[model samples]
Target chain A: MLAELMLSALLLLVTYWFIVTRRLSSAVSAYSVQSWLLGLVALALYVDTRLIGLLLFGLLIVSVKGILIPRLLRNRVAFALVAGRETSYYVRFPTALLIGAGLSLVGLLAATRLAFQPQLLPQSVLGISLAVFLLGLFTTIARRDAILQVTGLLAAENGLLLLSLVVAPGLSLLIEVAIVLDVLIAVLVMGFLVARMRDAVAGTDTSELTRLRG
Target chain B: MIDPALLLVMLATPLLGGISSALVRSDRVRYALVVPTCLVTLALALTLIARILATGPVSAFANWLYLDDLDAVVLLVVVVVSTLAGAYSIAYFRSDAQGHVLRPGELRKYFGLFHLFTFTMVLATVSGNLILLWTGVTATTFAAAPLVDFYGSHEPLEAAWKFLVLAVAGELIALLGFLLLYEAGIASLGSAYNFSIPVMEQAGPHLTASLGAIAFLMVLVGFGAKAGLAPMHTWLPDAHSQAPAPVCAMLSGAELNCAMLAIVRVLSLVTPANKARAGGLHEALLAFGLLSMAVGVVFLISQRNFKRLLAYSSVEQMGLIAAGFGIGAPVAAVGALLQMITHSLAKSLMFFNSGNLLLRFRTTTISEVRGAIRVAPASAILVIAGALAIAGAPPFGLFISEFTIIRGALLNHAWAVGAGIAALLMVAFLALMEPFNRMVFGQGRGEPLPARAELGLGVLAPGYILLAAVLVLGVWIPGPLHSMLVGASQVVDR
Candidate 1:
């Protein structure tokens, strides 16, 4: 249990890095590391439950999310940054970090207030899961580059899965597979779009997309 | 007894057809394949509805696949719109190819994704489990994203990107809500019960009110985003306006219903738990509804692009339907469902009309094109009729549904809301008419369209059929359909 908490703390740290980082590639790397930790956490859960489904889920997470997706995102960032270093945050770094910290606190408070079944899971898991979730959302909103936003989105999904695993460990295999595959396809589509945006408009920054607005 | 195997066939036909469309080499062969596949799928859906009416409801695969009155209503709308749009795509793309707007090779990609989009929506409508339903919605974003970016240009790509990001973010929240509800379920009913709709409904009263309310609100916000409710509806206009017209029609017409159906399923599960808390849910929905309508009308007044204008109008129509659902009266629920059907029909026809104009005039700006009636008389008339029908003019189905919604609001002692909706509808009508009149009757600014400009029957047939259905539904609903509406309303009614 202490090991699990330690890994979660490391995961939170990586999420904070997502907020402070300005380079799109760094943010992407932070996201990949965060996903690796998430896979580790899933492996820990599998060790406890001895469920082969969780074991396979952990392996898939590490491979698909931690390895495959980051490689895809890196290719996007590599060609994308050749033009110039891009500013990814609308809010200033300090202010965005402060806001992200507050969001994390709110998550903790809200999680504690919920009447979760006590015998089934530890309370801290719920609070930490929510904090991770909120931080990811903050990252998405704060980032201007579309790739970082996709990274932020993946982090948020990781947080949700953390909460779900603790609260409902018995979720059917079908749902787990569906959730993973859904995220995978979403990332693939976003990667394709970002690549296309770079090739067509010369940048992956969403601010460039102001041609049609009411 | 109905054969349960038929449901599998309904689901498989689209999947196989979509795959085959992608693999086929010849565009002509692909187009031919698309129409027949759509027809078969439509037949299967109609048969499913008939069997559901006959057998009450059908559950298969341990309740993983289910069909009830609510599913049938939504299924009927999807099949009708998809069938029309699939048939219409042939002529629509042919014009684009001829005009050099799109290459002939791109038609294969468009047709393939079109069928895939239809299949995802169909899966969402029929799936019995909430998770599977969520899966269906997620798949829709993936399938439709490419379709939206069919042009592979800057504008369409940007629009498709926003559509993907916003939709994924919103749906993830809904997933969190589902997790929370699952936690609540385990707390109440133990772990044996799964996340199937029937199972959740059975265990509804045992769910804690506080948790259920939160879950419902999450659903309203999340699914509401996909439904193009305001604030989260940022993706709607960009994606709708930039997509090829037939794709836009599917996105605006059938896709929004699938999202709303998700919200309805969640509401039903929560309502049985606590009556007053459920009212809170309704109040939240009502607030979003009004806000969406207000925001939509404001944009409608100033929108320059005709396609985006239609997108904002869709926001208004969806907002009205959301208000109907929020009122939670059986009458309002019926109106909401009816408006969904009518909006799908009228909105698709209007979009197809816009497509015709775009092909002829080569522009989407209302101010740029003038004296449309003199160029293509048939298209001009169709656009005018569609404009009138969508504006809730009498003798159209939207008019009836809007009236039903107002009466339901009044029945709920929401006179102010009723008045507000009525005023907004008038403002929307004026906004729409101002632009539509300019395009149809205003003096030409450039050379008149070629005297030979004419519409093929294949192109007009689907839209004509839709307008006729909307007109007929205004004055009359067949017995089976009426019963279906009542049954669906009961599912959501208190």
Candidate 2:
């Protein structure tokens, strides 16, 4: 239980870091690490609970999210204007990171309020999950570039995966497959659009794509 | 046999028709087939509606589809709108430069994509799982993307891309929500969850309450994008106003409802204890719905484009439906379902008639077209009827449904009901009065409404039929439908 709770907090921290930092490659690498930890958590449950379903789900997460998704984005997504210097963030990185920490603490405080049987997993997993969800929302709102926005979108997915891991846990590998398939499709479409954006507007900035503004 | 053939046909006919029309290269044949194929679809929808009503929830391919009372009602509305949209499209395309003059190949692909979109929407309604439902949504976005850019112009293409980005981004958020749901409550097997409503519900108690709440919020925002709920409804007006009229009908009439259904199903699975703690998802929906309705009304009052005004009205209607679900009572739930039915029927009818007026006037700016009564009298009457029904005038089912929602709100809480009623009146007035003043009496700088291709009686019939059904539904509730509504409503709880 302690192990799962720790795992959830660690992943949440990593996601917040990925969203707040300035270096594009480093942020992507942090995200890859986060996905790896999520897969590890999935696998750990597979071994601890002897649940065969988690193995396939874990493997898919590790391979597709950790390896394939990052690789596609990295290779297909050109440097994307070398990051940094976007106008207007809801919160600065350090502040968002601090806010994320505050959310995690609040999450823990709420978990105690739930007063569950105090399994390490159930007690703190709730806090980590909620904080992660908020951080993802924060990232989506803050980011300007399309690829980064999509990455924020992925972080949002991670938040959800963390929440689901704590809630209704025994769905199947099929849901995992579905998630990966959607991610892959999204990556492809965004990749295509990224190139199109570059071609049409001569820059891959998402703000430039705002052609239909009121 | 659950009649897999019928399902396949539903999927096939539109794609085939789209292709042949593109290939034939003659506007005459495009005119010939669009109406006939849609009529066949209407026939199929009617039979499907009757069969579902008679047979009670058709399940097939091992629970992939559980077409029951709710879906049957939706399916009936689809038949009404899509058929008329099709007939209207026939006359509609004659004025479309590309549809009339395009090389066979370009025409085929455009029409093919349109049918594919219809098939995807139908599949979304019939689907029983969350993932497939999401897939259907993504499919619609992709299919509509090219159609929006069909004019091959820079601005439309840009609009299409923007539409894709926001909608896909929103949908991905929804996908994440569903995934979290998949992760909820570890059974002994200790894995992520399936997309089944039942599986999630069965695991409800075992799951962490906060996780469920978080999942609900994410899915709400996600589906809200498609449903045209505000703060996330940015893509809707731009897309609807720019897309072809039939496409606009599909976008408003069917796709938004499909996304809303996904949210409704997810909310139903929220554990009772969690719902109590979080105020369920209703409060959240109510807040968003009211914001959307108010925003829609404000925009509707200010709009000058005929099509844009209608699009804003859709946003307002969707908000009302969302708020209905948020009210979270048996009466409110059924009211929400009935609204879904009536909105689809009326919006499609409205869009189809709008298509006719467009053919007559060759422009969509409200300032450019007027005295619809003088030009295309038959279509004008249908469009006006559609507008009246949508505006919550009596005899339309929407009026009954909307009134039921307000009354349900009042019964639940007088203050909330009053607030809701005010919003409805404001929006309803904006949509009906603002547009009619100009459309019925105002004149624009352009060629007046022209008499074009033969306006088929079939084209006129579907909109009126839908309005007629709306009228019948307002004053009456048949016993069987009442039972189904009662049953579905019982599932929603605080």
Q: Write the per-residue lDDT of candidate 2 for residues B1-494, one digit (tens) a residue.
A: 74556665765676677677667766566667776777776676656656665666565655555565565556655656666666656555655532336554555655666666666677676766667767766667766777776655445656776677678768867876665565444432154334554445556666666656776887899888988999888878887777778888888898788788778777776646375574546888888888888888878876777777888888888988888888766677778888887788778777776766666667777777677777667767777777887787777788888877777777677466547656766556656766765675555566645543445675566566766777788788787667656655655542
Model 2 whole-model lDDT (C-alpha atoms): 0.69
How good is the docking of model 2, as DockQ? 0.24
lDDT of 1 by residue, A1-214 (tens): 6666777778877888878877777777887898899888778878876877678778888998899888877775568755344564588888988998898889879988997875334777788788888888777877788877888899998898778777776777778888888888887778778888877778878888877677
lDDT score at residue A11, model 2, on the 0-100 scale: 90
Give per-residue CA lDDT, model 1, range B384-409, as digits (tens).
88999999999999999999999988
Model 1 TM-score is 0.96
Docking class of 2: acceptable
Task: Please give the CA lDDT of all the candidate structures.
Answer: 0.84, 0.69
Best by DockQ: 1
- Runs in model 2 deviating more than 4 A are A1-52, A66-133, A162-169, A210-214, B1-64, B78-80, B83-91, B97-109, B130-195, B198-218, B271-283, B410-419, B443-487, B490-494
Could you report the DockQ of all the candidates, in the order they appear? 0.68, 0.24
- TM-score of the A chain in candidate 2: the value is 0.84
